[model samples]
Target: MTYLASPSTLFGRLINRTQYADLPWSNILAINFLRGRLNRLSANLPNLIEELSDENLQSAWKVLQPLYYDLYMLRAIQESKQIVQPGETLTREEALRLLHFP
Candidate 1:
């Protein structure tokens, strides 16, 4: 049987193998790729949802949400770090809304 680690574990392993200085750009590239994939999926979602039973859709969402949330947080943090000016900082409400901080 194959055992899979959590998404964060897998992501950490990938990053640790790369040069730290390359992380910001590499992460941005990954984010863009994921965004494109998500956009394509979203465009198809209505048809897909029409065919899916509610139980099946819920099951798929349960599996997908964590991976998507992790990638989102990674993108947010990376972009926040890359912000160069005080004016570029996210507003308190915007940061809260985007990051879903507790």
Candidate 2:
């Protein structure tokens, strides 16, 4: 428990537990909802970025920063197996790790 007391602890927790993390079907549905939005955001990012002139890069940075981080973290999670046939519920650390962080 002490290990997860801080934000940095949660960051470290994600790397180890992201693999094969299980999720309930309802949660899966919700994740799918958000994932569609995320996909749209990700797809637009490059074009939006390309339209920016050098002077506007500062403003673009704000959007790109969060987008980049989410992509990395999401990729980490997806490296795990998705939708196991037996449908295991997520374990303690993984459950905490997924919902608690951004």
Per-candidate Cα lDDT values, in order, are 0.65, 0.57
Give the least accurate 10-residue stretch of model 2, judged by summed lDDT.
1-10
- Give the alpha carbon lDDT tens digit for every residue of 15-68 in model 1: 332456656876867865666665566567678777998899889879977877
Position 50, candidate 1: lDDT: 77
Q: Which candidate is the best by lDDT?
A: 1
* Candidate 2, 4-57: lDDT as tens digits: 123332233222224435756666566556656655666566687678788788
lDDT of 1: 0.65
User: Candidate 1, TM-score vs. the true structure?
Assistant: 0.40
All candidates' TM-scores?
A: 0.40, 0.33
How many angstroms is residue 12 displaced in model 1 relative to the true structure, after the best TM-score fit? 22
TM-score: which candidate is best? 1
